[model samples]
Target: MASSNYEVIRLKRDLPAQGVVIHQITDDRMKTGVPLHDALDRLLEAVKGKVLLVHYAKIERDFLEAATKRFYGKSLPFLMVDTMQIERRRLERTHQSIQSNQLRLAYLCQQYQLSK
Candidate 1:
């Protein structure tokens, strides 16, 4: 779902025994300011029954926590898997080096050959 203030990308795939859906929420409301609950609502609707949430960082978790407080009673239930953490694990396991002071995703992707 694409909105003027935000763009939500959803991908669904059916494995041999299970179904999975992934949601990517881009924060385009930097100036206009979209509500956290609104974004969470869209995310919840997209991954209502999926197993995992693959997000770039822990921002999604913080967003969900705030949204849950905003809604009070209604919130989605799911586990958040930070892609950053996954990459960090892979780099540590493989003993990759960080040349500079930056820990960007591009660097991690290159180290892990996860770039597309």
Candidate 2:
């Protein structure tokens, strides 16, 4: 996932045994010359044989591919999930809005009896 403020890249190694592992990248380093491929390598080393989950998979894949080509001369591993899409599917099945764009999380919590 690539965002102006933050980027998260995740990968999966095993299935039905181990859960997902996520790597989060944020802060001013995003503005510097630090290569995203290096960051992904570090993240990969941290969780080599674990399943990874991310909010958006396509964006992450694109960014990782580009970053890898620039920094490592090859593409890294490809594995991810889009939680937003999953949530949307669930919400569609339920016929209810899982979240509202007009309402903040705090406001939604108050409106929907969710804990603060």
Candidate 3:
């Protein structure tokens, strides 16, 4: 087992992330060519007290849990913050006349002047 650590990450969606890519932000590393299990080991080490900021966390959460179970024979616990879900709630609470589809990652990022 590796020593415990903490890091923030934004999993790349433009590319296939599972079994293809995982970005380790602390070191600014884009790791590839490694097995997903090994990659997740690095991620899990830093899972403590951190909420993963995922674009679409509902789907991402299911995918991560399934992949973790498949690769490690057990699923690990982690927190996630879905930007899309939060944006949808914000629109509803603010009574903004916005379509649900407009809660997409690109639109939210653009509205907030963020690079996606």
Candidate 4:
């Protein structure tokens, strides 16, 4: 891999919502930014054997597909579990009356009394 300076800001390890934020490259931060190709390569490797659980998959899939095509000359193939889709399917199976905002993450969580 090509050498580059990367600044990874990780939340506390004990936090329930652990995440890492890679700062965007600005004129001042250019020296510390990894190229898009490198970032995508790393992301692909990290998620290779994982099933992505997302609130909405379409946006994620579209962005990844575009990135993979641009960087690797191919489409990204990965499994995804969309919570919104799951709720929609469940509601359909039960023949429940669906509200306009029923499938939204916040709405579903609120309906189920789950903490955001």
Candidate 5:
């Protein structure tokens, strides 16, 4: 299932385990036969050997694993990079303050002037 927080999704795909994406999975799409589970299946199959990048790693890691088990009776072979966690670690190492919710994607991007 998708998160309620994101209004749209944009998935990119490469080789199996390389990378795969499914963005903008709206309700209409689900009704049109692209069930959430099916969308996730496509993602899992596509990212067979790839590292997935996300703003927060925990959500995708925890949720996708649970969903994979529930729907496929197994685990998802997921390799992920959490930019937020990386930033947090970097800040901690430098003895810098986390600054409220600066770990959020938007905030971090704004702080560093990233286009994303």
Candidate 6:
């Protein structure tokens, strides 16, 4: 559904000047934030014919499916590449010992020398 009343998420960059680069969504924002369906509609339209690359699929898949079903009363059909699974498979194939944190997005990115 098309909507003009989407929630606006504001990020204050002033904290970064004080060396705090990570910003957390405050309780105020959480309570005021709109449902995911609105954003999902636009995102799905924009990413048509594009494969989404994500760190973990479970969370993203769950959220997308839930939103799609809730808003449109239909299933969401989309392609997604889970980097965490890919790295896990690679490590398993190479017979390397997998650490608990090895499959994490940040850890996998570090292994592949990806910049933050």
lDDT of 2 by residue, 6-100 (tens): 33333232222222222223333234434455666676675566555655577767876787777778887766766556656776888986556
Name the runs in model 1 displaced over 4 angstroms. 1-35, 74-76, 99-103, 106-116
In angstroms, give how far residue 49 of model 6 lies from its true place: 1.0
Measured with C-alpha atoms, the lDDT of residue 95 in candidate 2 is 93
C-alpha lDDT of residue 9 in model 1: 29
Candidate 6 lDDT tens digits, 24-68:
545455456554556676778876787777778988788778878
Candidate 4 residue 58 Cα shift, in angstroms, is 1.9
Clashing pairs counted in every model: 0, 1, 0, 0, 10, 0
How large an RMSD does model 5 have? 10.3
Using TM-score as the measure, name the better of candidate 3 and candidate 5: 5
- Residue runs of model 2 more than 4 Å from their true location after superposition: 1-34, 97-116
| TM-score for each candidate, following the candidate numbering | 0.52, 0.51, 0.64, 0.61, 0.65, 0.71
In the predicted model 2, the residue pairs found to clash are 20-51
Clashing pairs in 1: none
**TM-score pick, better of 1 and 4:** 4
- Over 4 Å off in model 6, which ranges? 1-23, 32-34
Candidate 4 ranges with C-alpha deviation above 4 Å: 1-38, 113-116
What lDDT would each prediction earn against the true structure? 0.53, 0.55, 0.66, 0.70, 0.67, 0.69
Each model's RMSD to truth, in Å? 12.5, 12.3, 7.7, 10.2, 10.3, 8.0
lDDT of 2: 0.55
Q: 83, model 4: CA deviation in Å?
A: 1.1
lDDT of 4 by residue, 1-116 (tens): 22222333232233222222222323434444566677777877777788877778998799789989987889979798899889989999999988999988778889899754
Could you give candidate 3's per-residue lDDT for residues 1-116 as a string of tens digits? Answer: 33334333343433444434333233224332445666677777666667787777868788788878898888777687788878878988999988866977767777899865
